[model samples]
Target: MKLKRCFDLVAGLIGLCLLAPLMLLIACWVKFDSPGPALFVQQRVGRHGVPFAIFKFRTMAHDGTAGNVPRMWPAPCITRAGHWLRRTKLDELPQLANVVLGQMSLVGPRPELARYVACYPPAVREKVLSVAPGITDWGSIKYRDEGSLLAAAADPERTYIEDILPVKLAFYQRYVDQRSFWMDLRIIASTVSTLWR
Candidate 1:
């Protein structure tokens, strides 16, 4: 997947350059609208069960998430600006750094919190973690409304583990089985379309 890495490096660098201004604006909005750093740093499981600190815009209030849970979490802790950032997916822009650093791919299984990854069955986990995790993937587009769906559940954590996660895992398996440059391109295109809608 050296070619994929090359694409990720170039695209990530270019993306950061192009989105710098908008990222700056969002950073300001987060600062003014809340009392924390604009960047949210969290440990997620990368390829082969390795942990890495991935970055996203702060879409929750300071001290909102003392711990990560494996569930949809558009909680009351979301600030006004944070809500918008999450809605528009602008919060994920900083992940270009992760892409450039080779911690992630542009199109592959979305990285999961270690807490969530811990829940994966042994064989399933091995297979899923065999490749680099991604910022967007087939599972991501299908589960684009995950936060909202989780918000509506009677038990968000339970629902995610029992329902949402399995579905996402199935898609992950398909993506792994069928992956290629063209498939990656399609996944990226689908991701953009999902965001636009």
Candidate 2:
């Protein structure tokens, strides 16, 4: 909607301005913490199933690979500072830029990696990809400690595909079906409160 778009633009701009110093500090910390670029760009499935690069402050070591890899949560690939960034969700700050660029929305379904997107059935993909991908969503708030959850699994990827992803997809489809400006605001407020708590 027009109001939602305006809200995204205004809030995103304000967030960027207010978080500028923090973002800079994070960039410097990431650089010193690891021998790789401060920012990480990964291809994600966005609106209409389009592929776009999602940006975040690098929260893993340079050699890290996407998705579940064997038994570990790939924890070893995360640098010390990266752990803090990921834990505090500061790594997601860069996505405000993505929202500003119209590559994403303030709230909707979280973007999926191309590999995961490939597993989405055609009908489900059509429903989920109907709107712009978001930085946070119901699934995100509910599964805030997803890394730990995955770590507990005997086969993380299989558990994700069979269980976690289906639940997330249900929430995603619900959001798509009933999304409104006020709903977005509520989601944002809920996210902030959840994070604070």
Count of residue pairs whose backbone atoms collide, per candidate: 0, 0
State residue 64's C-alpha deviation in candidate 2, in Å. Answer: 7.8
lDDT of 2 by residue, 1-197 (tens): 78877888899999999999999999999999889889988888899988888888887777655422321256677789877887778889999999999989989999987788888889999999999999899998998888778878898888888989999999999999999988998899999999888
Q: Which pairs of residues collide in candidate 1?
A: none
Poorly placed runs, candidate 2 (over 4 Å): 64-72
Q: In candidate 1, residue 26 scores what lDDT?
A: 90
TM-score on alpha carbons, each prediction: 0.95, 0.94
Reference-based lDDT, each prediction: 0.86, 0.86
Task: Pick the TM-score winner.
Answer: 1
C-alpha root-mean-square deviation, candidate 2:
2.2
